[model samples]
Target: MPLIKNVIHRFHVKRPLTARERELRLDIRKPAGDAPHYQLSLIRLNSTFVECVDKWYAERGFGAMFGAAAFSAVAFGMWVLVTNIFKHWHPIGLFFLLVFPVLLAVTAYIFLCDAFTYTHYPIRFNRKNRQVYAFRPDGTVLKAPWDRVYWTILGHANPLGWLNVAGHVMDESGKTVLETFALSVNSTSKQGEVKLRNHFEFFRLYMQEGPAVALQRIQPVPLIMLPPIDRQKESWAFGWERITLTLNGSPLLQILAQVFFLPESLFRWIVMRTSKIPQWPQWVEDECRIEPDDPWRREPGYRDEEAIAAMQATAGARRNG
Candidate 1:
């Protein structure tokens, strides 16, 4: 049983990063210089392709467990209703009975689908060159002009205010060239909010005021609030085809697709485990690299002395007035 558990653990869990990998890995907190170029630290184990594969498998297993638990809970509840109240079926119970299955099935299908489809390509921003590059897992690269990129924040206002910073590059006709998943930030506390605002301000300044203007320490513009209508439109624009087909199409077909795709996803997972990930090109390495020590790097809510003084003065004035 110990041996079996060890094997299962190896298959399902990612190994921790080596000392050398940790030393060399980019830290997103310390953006290189005060310039408009920055790269978000890779999610999970990104040092090697093998580690990434392990992380993927682990994620899939956890996802499956969660989905199963949800489905089973719903199913059991419905079963109890059917057995106990067969003659006096309540409308709410009947509604749940009908809706829960579809919801669970759809949820399961999405959960499984993500296990295969989710890809985390490294993204870099270069305000100087007016370019954005995404290094794909397959050794290919996607590049887009800065002007063509559109960015928005997807966040909820709560005690632990979490934000997802997402963007996409589009052509003149508004066709998407490349899109990035949210680089999540926790903004629940005052410090977290400052960090989130700083990062957002960096991008906003570069885009609106240009690199030269951004170089100067100007006050940050308030983060824009995306309306529900706009958020819905963005969602539709991002993955409308897949979403529409999955929701509107035959349930039978959905189940069949899930069944068939399982093997393929498993095969890919196996391949990723066995094969080595290619090393990034020298150009990409240089472009995306983060420096260890940058003057601009600071703890959340702690600005440089000059900025701190200015902020304090402003707050004092507001209180006095």
Candidate 2:
């Protein structure tokens, strides 16, 4: 969890795209609903921006806590080893004591920061400004132009059939992969690529064509008002996913998974209690302010017909008036 998110900046911007990152086109202008499977990551989708957490690790708490604990345990063990060697004033222990603890401390800190510091690292796609804003773990936000970003469905070989659908910030010449932020990376099966395609198409359509047009074009999964999450409040479900358990849809496996969910849910609750909700910079919020009659805004769980009709009518009335 923290291992990946904390080091996301390592690749840096202005570098060339990797061969793995270059594959797959997420062109929604190509088709409509090949296989709709959204991970239900939309925190809020209004006139100004569409907000979502990392879909791959939506159920973030337990895994993140485990990661932090693992690092901490190893760090502590290394310190004990260093002390055992140094109590008698061994010269060799000097470097080991100083370096090992320092490295472990830094590792522990990163994981702790991930598990207890912030609730979630949200990626916001602002349609009004045509910009993408990613909230980093280190109290800063990365902003990039929407059109200039390389949007695609990335297939990974290590995770074996796993795919990541995300947007990349390329170098000035538009060839190198400078920065990477994702929509979702949870899809694992080969068929997950198709589901991810449909999922990516949801946002692609929303960003490119607006919610009204997107509502008309989407299918299979059927777009609806996903209950908006509290941006400033942390809850037990804070880092959870909408549809959990990739147990091949087997009832027995799902039941077994549920048996383990008890402990998982407890860890999730513990993580949020120690963590704080993320707060975007005031300037960013100011830019995100909505108009009183903003047509692009709609409540979660709103029907497609109503979504299309409501926003269109509002826009139409404004144009007419």
Candidate 3:
């Protein structure tokens, strides 16, 4: 029982996100007009770590269960057909019957292991320097130039497309520098496509033609506000409140609520297993230690108009000089 307890503790214990982390995860907005640095929004499938793991397990379990049911139905039909035709047992029929249980068990075990073992890391994009910062839970920080990184939207056709943006980084010689697990944005609605496209274009333009050109290009698009789709709560009452507020009057949620009724404890357990806490890289730490100017620090409430005006004035001054 102690061994089982240990396993449960490792896989089922939940870690709650601090307010700051919660804010960071949910705040999906474009860079402020005046801020010198812009932080790319962190995308995730679920709000809490445990919830992500739970969803992972739930999805795999559902797939496995469906596959087993389909297989069993086909096998049963074949058995009936063979018995009616031959009036005796056949080797093929027996084989199908024997394999069904084994297949179900194997699929269940595989999905269970997957649910408990997978971990996700946070990837941050800095628009100012065109840099990507990947934080490992083990306190290691990996950095690369934006040009070295590549990204793809996995489910572009899906209405909730922001959940599909995935990326990885490579070295100058075309060697893989770091392999990132698929990360998803919080928005699961069709509107996410616009947000995803805007963000991608924002960075790409800035990197390709500097900030001035990028700003001009992005100016026409209205500001995007991507609020949290999944809310993490400490209790069932809180969860209910969140559901009512966030998912109120949605027919999809009504259907989902009926199909997958997740209790609070199970949701927490899954999040605890899958979520990874990000740590600051050693270089960032060292730089802050040596100087007061921390490059990674975000300027709160920075405005884009101010930045654009400043850039234009600098250009005009240079031309006159």
Q: Rank the candidates by TM-score, best first.
A: 2, 3, 1
lDDT of 3 by residue, 139-246 (tens): 355566655554544333455432433444444454342443233333466565455445455545455555455545654332221122123212334333333333
How close to the true structure is residue 148 of candidate 1, measured as C-alpha lDDT? Answer: 58
* Candidate 2 lDDT trough over 10 residues, lowest sum: 238-247
- Write model 2 residue lDDT over 1-321, tens digit each, in one string: 555446632334567776655557555455535544445566676777877776434555556555665777777877687668746777866777677766766666555544565666678888889888887777688899877778776656345554667778777787878777777545666766677777777777777877676655654334554554444444455333332344445878666776556556566666566666777898888877877787767654555675567777777999999
Q: How many residue pairs clash per model?
A: 0, 7, 11
**Judged by lDDT against the true structure, how good is candidate 1?**
0.41
Per-residue CA lDDT of model 1 for 1-321, tens digit only, reads 223112211111123323432333223334322433112221211111100111122122334445555777777876787786678767787777788778777555534433333232344455445566655434466567656554444344467544434444445565432333333233444344345455555555554444344435434321111222111212222222222232234777656665534443453343333333334468755754434553322221222366557777888999999
lDDT of each: 0.41, 0.64, 0.40
The model with the greater lDDT, 1 or 3, is 1
Q: What TM-score fits each model?
A: 0.37, 0.71, 0.42
Which runs in model 2 stand beyond 4 Å of their true positions? 1-5, 8-14, 27-38, 68-113, 155-162, 218-228, 232-234, 237-250, 299-321
- Please say which candidate is ahead in TM-score: 1 or 3: 3
Candidate 1 error regions (>4 Å): 1-40, 43-66, 85-96, 119-121, 125-130, 134-142, 147-156, 159-161, 168-181, 184-191, 197-321
